[model samples]
Target: MKVFTQFTDEEVRKAQVSVLELLLINHPLDCPVCDRGGECPLQDQALAFGPGASRYEEAKRTYRKPLPLSPLVNLDRERCVLCARCTRFCDQISGDRFIELFDRGGAEQVGISAGQDFRSPFSGNTVQICPVGALTATTYRFAARPFDVATGDTICPHCGDNLDVNDAWACDKGRFAFSFVDQPTRLTTPLLRDHGLEPASFDETLAAVATWCRGGRAAVLAGGRLSNEDAYALSKLARTGLRTNDIDARPFPCDPSALPAERAQATGGMAVTYRDVELAKLIVVVGLDAEQEVPILHLRIRKAARQGARIVVIHPRRTRSYDVAEHV
Candidate 1:
């Protein structure tokens, strides 16, 4: 007789549902009040592969709710399932050794070290990687729902890294500094100036723009903030729609022809990437200060330096990066 194990999609889903049902036994159904609502993994899992009705009808376990992990990090002990993802990340990746599982078995809970604060540079990652809404950023807590906000895949204006500024995994600045995007004084509608500026529909605005461009020389001055697709569209519009050959994306170019070599170097694609920085034996820093300019870049440089990469900074004044640099 021969026996082999086989699991089909339905069987796997059933097993998943069983596990999730147990996970959700003590979980609160306060999805509306949760900041991670609409983007929560626990909520998604329950909806996708879970028992339609919870069989465990006992009163759910409760804690004080949102025990202070640190000034930046908050812990909702009741929401936690003792999954050590955050603890492991802190121990292995960030090297902070702050967050850890306290106690054992049924009493196991994740927390910061005794008398130690979760003050690591990468503490935000814990709030991001929490499978449930167990860990949350104090600043972003109850600020907005995931569905209420719009997300754009944009590069970090600080460091040019391809990161979504509004994402859960975004750095503190990228996530919380976007409140300016919704200022009450900020323009929300397209403005057209006939005698004075007045809000106009997009179609009307386009018609007015077309009228202004017709039989006139027009140059598309796109910004670096524009996505590559947007830049391409604007380039095409300059040639096909506007009937002009002048189009520029770089903001500081007084004369595009003056610095052909520099322009090529700037737009010729990345000469050195984060990978190169990580693997290089010697890294020479020019005018760029990684720490202030790009915290993530600084972190990468620090990691590389820790791995025996020699860092040399060439600047008149000492930068924050000089802490990690071999020479300044």
Candidate 2:
């Protein structure tokens, strides 16, 4: 029952070399321009364990360059080593069978069905887990090499510290929809409507806003991006300072009384969690499309269904969870 993993033995070293060679038999040599060039696992393994030179001189297999699997993901068939990480992620984790290993033998590659697109909310994860540059994110296509980029640790704005919630996964919006921060049209300062829209100093803008508030009624309209403390302060300001009941934080109009009970259930010590969903006997969803709204929750609901939980979704239309849940 002895297991050897280190390449100390000559046979083990030779076996490792052979495996690397076979994996690189048809792997393209376009690492110089690849998005995963500097951080690729295959590149590091090839440099460490692969033979110094290749013996094959025949023409390499090719595919149409940079096939758009979706608006967020692109595929280069020739660069794929058939590791099946992307396919497995889709099948096992996201439950979105958008792409699969098509064809057979040497011609086998990852692809989607004709006229189909990778439309999953978790599709960006495949690019993150790819061993090679076969799968690349469209937003990051040739944007920067790994060595050229600087990264810093920051709290995820979507979900805070609940490990049982998303389980180390982020939806595509949280993962890739960050380009707007750097867009040219993004507002950096307050704009005053003096002669159309002109950038004004914070003091000037606040003074004008205060004058307007003093003149007439001001109803607080807070955006969803506000924190709990900010929301509380705004609520106080709207209730006491402005003496108005017309305050809403939601982007859409809804009855003020419609959500307080629901919010109390979530915040008043009785919260429905992912673990609860996984162990529940029955889950009744009302007016909520989990897959389109909260993808990680959708995955948890699917897991619960696989574990023999009955899921009943009451929505206006059928959702992606229809396969695993009963539609009402």
Query: lDDT value for candidate 2?
Result: 0.81
Query: Candidate 2, clashing residue pairs?
Result: none
User: Which tens-of-lDDT digit does each residue in 1-328 have in candidate 2?
Assistant: 8776635578888889899998998888898999999899989999988999998889878889899999999999989999999999999888889999988998889999999999988998898889898999998898888999987655445433223323356778667765657889888899999779999999999888877777337887898668799999999887877777788767333334335444656445757777898899898776666765566778888889888889887666777778888646
**Poorest stretch of ten by lDDT in candidate 1:** 251-260
RMSD of each: 9.0, 3.7
For residues 162-219, what per-residue lDDT tens digits would candidate 1 score against the true structure? 2645532345555455667778999888999979999999999999899888764777
Off by over 4 Å in 1: 1-13, 57-59, 157-170, 178-270, 281-293, 302-328
Prediction-by-prediction clash tally: 0, 0
Instruction: Evaluate residue 42 in candidate 1 and report its C-alpha lDDT on the 0 to 100 scale.
Output: 86
Worst 10 residues of 2 by lDDT: 158-167
Task: Please list the C-alpha lDDT of all candidates, in the order they appear.
Answer: 0.75, 0.81
